[model samples]
Structure formats: structure tokens, C-alpha cells
Target chain A: MIDRTGLMVILSSPSGAGKSTLARRLMEWDAGLRFSVSATTRAPRPGEVDGVDYHFTSRAGFEQMVADGQMLEHAEVFGNLYGSPRGPVEQAMLAGRDTLFDVDWQGGQQIRASALGRHVVSIFVLPPSLPELERRLRGRGQDSDAVIAGRMEKSRSEISHWAEYDYVLVNDDLDETEARMRAILTAERLRRDRQSGLGGFVRALMAEEA
Target chain B: MIDRTGLMVILSSPSGAGKSTLARRLMEWDAGLRFSVSATTRAPRPGEVDGVDYHFTSRAGFEQMVADGQMLEHAEVFGNLYGSPRGPVEQAMLAGRDTLFDVDWQGGQQIRASALGRHVVSIFVLPPSLPELERRLRGRGQDSDAVIAGRMEKSRSEISHWAEYDYVLVNDDLDETEARMRAILTAERLRRDRQSGLGGFVRALMAEEA
Candidate 1:
């Protein structure tokens, strides 16, 4: 295998499309794959782990990181600050290990616009149908009726940005969507431009028996 | 699976890089995938079937087709004329079945420059090393020393065009390379812009419970 430069995999989706579930499964499938543990000012829920689930931070701390150019992308949701750190993602890329981003379209666009944008492979996940999406959100039972309504509106807005993504997968089934993500990674890794060592490798090939 | 628009797969490689082997494996994997049948002025070797292996034609006949603007791409090799017909490729695309082109860099460039170019996914296959490539070619033992020398020179010339491809895969092993090609096809089909019905689907998604 060629020592390929790692990619930044940005998985964007509207709420209830199971983006988190798919991202988690991908991490499990490849242990070396790193997750962009987002920094958030929101308090951790019952089972959440700091630095694992998210890097819990004070609002000021998050703002400081953003000001210092440490955050790859940042945004506020329900008065809580959340952002992806640039350090770990950069480290992962240099180490030839991919970093997975579970972000919305706004965050996805920001990362794609960043200096390291060329390293990114952006995929948008669409729920099978709007009714099914609403059903999945309701099945989670974590949000109230008003919250669901808000989420539905946000989803519509998010879907508008689907055209911006490099790949768009309709999440009709969990395993299939996960499989598609795996395929994208497998293929993207082989792109000529992504393999930095190709120049040296090709030169070595030419030298033999020439 | 999404009903994806068919793509034009162009696989180019230096001699002995196993391009033909991988292309054959892909055809076997998906019987629906069409192998582009090129029209050639060369006479059929004993068992070569008309319209199957190649559309064997007289030089004048091939020239007429070229003059009529029937060929998507045409080239002269050694002393024979060979060209890919446009009609079947367009028809296959409309039927939602990908057509594979095992062409050299020149042919690949022509097809990419054609009107159907946007649907093309071009891949270049490289041998693991020059020594290995020579070993594979010699193992075939089907060419004279002078012919082999000419092929080696041609291979080097072909390798120069590797940068023109969308993806470059090192053909170190057969099965692994075939698997990579399959993955590329799977991912390329999911590119958002390739699925034309996506707009209607997303609009329908918004219509639900809004």
C-alpha cells in the first residue's frame, strides 16, 4: 500500500439521519481513524465523557481557541458554543490517519473553506424520506414537540446545502450507508494528488532497468 | 441502491501494469457493465469474433465512419485504425449501465474531451516497479526482442501521462487492485450531481410535515 496522506472526512446531515451512529460505526471499523472530538461549552449529559465524547470547555475558553485560530470551525446551538479543534485534525493528517467530522452543513462548509480544505472529503447523508426522518427523531424520544418542530425546520434548511457536498448518500439503511462511507475512503485514498510519495515512487520505478 | 446515472470509466496504464486484467475482473463482477467495442481495420486473428472482440472493418469502412463523425475517439496503431463508437456508449449511459474503456492516454484524453466527458471517471494504473513491470511483460513471452524494446519505450511514454488521471492505483497485486476499482465505481456513482432525481427527492423531503 502507498503511504497516502490522510483525508478529512466530513459527514454532514440533517437531524435524525443517524450521522452520529454511522460515524461511530466507522471509527469502530477502523481503530486508527480519529474522531474530531468537538469542543463545546454545553455541559455533558449523563453518559458523556469529556475529551472523548467532546472536549467540554467554558464559553470563554472556546472563544479564546477560536480567536487563536485553534478551532477549525465553530458555531452556537441553543446558546451553547461548539467547535472542532484544528490541532488533532492536523496531527491525524500528518500521521496518515483520517479524522472523521460529525458536523452540519455550516461547519462542513467552514472546514472545506479552511487552509486544509483540499484534505477534506465531504459527504452528505439524507434520510430516506422526510416522514421517516421525523419518525426517527421521535423514536429517539429525547426532544419535545416544540424541539422536534425546530429540528424539522433546521433539517429543511440543511437539506438545501446538500448540493455543496462531494457525495450524497440517502440513508435508507444503516449498514449500507456505512458501507458507502467505507468505499469513499478506500477510493479517495488512491487519488494521485492525495498520495504525496507518488513522485518519488514513480521515479524509483523509472530508475529500475532504465 | 440509488438509480445512478451511468459513468464512463476510462482505465489507462503502461504495458504490463495489469489494466486489462483488472478491467476483465470488473466486467465479471458486474455483467451489466459493457466493455466498449472498438472498430478496427486489422484483420481478425483466427478466433476473434466480429462485433464481440472488435468490429473488424476494412480501412475504407473505418475511414467512412470517421468521416461521418461516428467515432467518439479514434487512433492509428502500428498500421491499424481503432476507434470507439459513440452510439453504443450513449445508449448504455441512457440505460443506466456503465461502459468501461480500456484505452491508452490519447484515447482517454479524447473521450474526456468529448461531450459526454463530465460523466467520465478516469483512472491510471501503474506497475509496482519498473523491474516488476518488465518481469510481467517478459513472462508473457508473446513478443520478439525488438517488439519488447518498443513496448518498453511506449510504456515509459504512457507513464508520463499518469498525472492526467483522476485516480492512480499501483498494480502491485491483482485482487487488491480489482477491489480498489470496484470501490471507485461504488463511490463515484454517489456523487451528488450525478443523481439527477435528487432535486425532486429533496423537494419531496421538504414537503413532508412542513
Candidate 2:
């Protein structure tokens, strides 16, 4: 197998745009893919395992990690500080394993501007239509009208950043969007800069006698 | 179907590296793909169709086209001028059809630096090994030992520029290489800049009422 450095693949979308389903399918498609688990200051719910669900930490601890530059990208969400830890991502990169991030546009921007930006492949997913998105949000049936309205506003704000991504897909059909994501992953893995062993491989080929 | 601007896909490699076979397979896979037939000052050989094989032109005519900015890129080889015509490629782009160019490293570099550089997706193919390359070169059994030696030297010169490509594949197996190329094409088609209709699509999405 060709040895390659890991890619930081960031998938961003509004709440009802099928990004979660696509991300889950991608992980199932490639067992080698590592899902980046964020470090959060919030308390874990029942059955949530540390390091698996998230790296649950105290607010002070989270702030220390951020100040020490251990966070690749961090943001404040609903009074909690959440961030992607750099240590696990760096380890994965050294081991030639790609890490996938499910983030909003703000986190995507932050990661793309980070020091490891060159390895990033950012994709934005769009809902088929605003009406479709509202339908899906309403389909959840757990939220009242006011909560759904607030979510719709948040979704609109997230959708405004579609042009900032490298690739954008309208998730009109889940299977097709999944296939496109697979294609993007496969192609990005073969990029010249990502293949770490190519230099040595080329040297060996050139040394062979005709 | 997603409407997209045309991609100028350039495939370059040393001779006997299976580039021709891969190009052929790609054409067969996508019927909409346009193979760039070059314009040349060389006289047409027996049974060679002028337009289909090459846009056979007089030396003066070729020079005039270059001076008029009609050639996307040009090169002189073996006392003949060869170039990719810009007119057809532009028309293809306007019609949302992709054009594939089978060129050497020099041609690839020129086209990439041209005005349409942003739309270009360049790939370099490498033979598995020098010995394997020599074996394939000899399999044809149509050249003298001196000619084969000269070809090997030329191949080495071509292989030196593999690092300049956006993507490079060591052609150990034809089927796997072809699959990778397809993935690259598919992913490139989804690039935000290539999809011309996306801006309006996003506008319509935002205009939808909650």
C-alpha cells in the first residue's frame, strides 16, 4: 500500500442537511478513517464514555488546553467550550490515518486557518431546499414551534458559508451524496503532497538498471 | 445533472508507462469527455485523417495561429510544430464539456500556466520500475537496441518532472490506476468553482421562506 500523510477532512452543514448520515457512511466505508472527538467543558450525559463520546473536561482544564495550543480549533457553543484536541490528530497523522471533523462553518474556518491547513479537505453540504430542511426539522417532532424557528435561523446562518468550502454538495439524495464524498476522499488521498513515500519510491525506480 | 464548467485535464507520463491505455479507458468511461486533437505542422502520414488525427496545417498557418493567440500551448519536436488549439477547448467549456489532453511534461506545464490554469487538473503517471519500463518497451519488438537505449534516456528525462504534477500515480496495475483517475475526475467536477450554477442555486435556497 502507498504510504500517505493523513488528511484533515472537515464536513460542515446545517442541522438537517444529512451531514451526519454522510459522515457515518464514510466511516463505515473506510474503517481506517478516524472521527475527531472534541473536548468539551460540558458534563457528559448517561452512558457517554470519555474519549469516545468526547474528552469531557473541567472548564479550567479546557481553557488551559486551549491556552497551551493543544486545541486545533475551538469555539463557544451554548455556554460550553468545545474544541478538537491536537494530540490525537497529530498521532493519527503520524500513523497515516485520516481524521474527519464534523464542524460548523466557524470551526471549519478555524481548522483551515490552522498550521495543518495544507492537509485540509473541506466540504460543505447543502439541504435540497429550505422547505425540505424545515420539513426534516419538523419531522423530528421533539421541538416546539419556537425552537424549530430558532433552529431554522441558525441553519440559514450556517448555509451562508457554502462558498467558503473546497467542495459543496447538495444532499438531495443521500446515496449519491455519499458516493461523491467517497470520491472526494479517494482522490484527496492520492494527491501528490499527501503521499509521503513517493520520493523514495521514485528514487528506487530510477536506480533500477534498464 | 449538475451543470459545471469544463475541466482541462492533462495526463502526462514517460512513454511505456500505460498512459495511453488509461486515457483510452477514461474516454470510454465518460462519453462526454472530449479528447484534444492537436494541431501540427507535420505532413499527414498515409491514411491519416487531417482533422481527426491532427489539425494538419502548413508551417506558416501554425505560426499564424500561435501569433494570433489561438494556441493554448505549443512545442517544437522533431522539426515539427505541435499545439493544442484554444478555440475548440473554449467552445467545450462554454458547452459544459470537459477536455482531456495527452501531452508531455512541457505541454502540461505550459497549459497549467496558461489563462485556463485554474480549471486544469494535471496528473503524472510513473512506471512501477525502470526494469519494468524496459520490459514493456522491449515487448513491442519493433526497435533496434540503439533506439531502445535512446528511448530509455528520454523516459528518464520525462520521469524527472513527475513531482510537478498535482497527482502522481505509480502504474503498478492498470485497473487500480484507472479507478483512481476516475475518482479524481469525479471529485474535481464537484469543486465549487467549477459548478457555475451553484451561486444561483444558493441564492434560491436562501430566498426560500421558513
Which digits, one per residue and each the tens of the lDDT, describe model 2 over residues B1-210?
567889999999989999989999999999989999999999899999988989999999999999999999999999999999999999998889999999999999999999999899999999988889989999999999998999999999999998999999989999999999999999999989899999999998899886
Query: Which runs of model 1 end up more than 4 angstroms from their true locations?
Result: B1-3
Candidate 2 CAPRI grade: high
Most accurate candidate by lDDT: 2
DockQ of 2: 0.83
TM-score of 1: 0.96
Stretches of candidate 2 off by over 4 Å are none
lDDT per residue, candidate 1, A154-178, as tens digits?
Answer: 9989999999999999999899899
What local lDDT score does residue B84 receive in model 1, on the 0 to 100 scale? 98
Consecutive 10-residue window with the lowest summed lDDT within model 1 chain B: B201-210
**What digit string (tens of lDDT, one per residue) describes model 2 on residues A87-130?**
98999998999999999999999999999999999999999899
Candidate 1 lDDT for residue A10: 94
Q: Give me the candidate number with maximum TM-score.
A: 2
Q: What is the TM-score of chain A alone in each candidate?
A: 0.95, 0.97
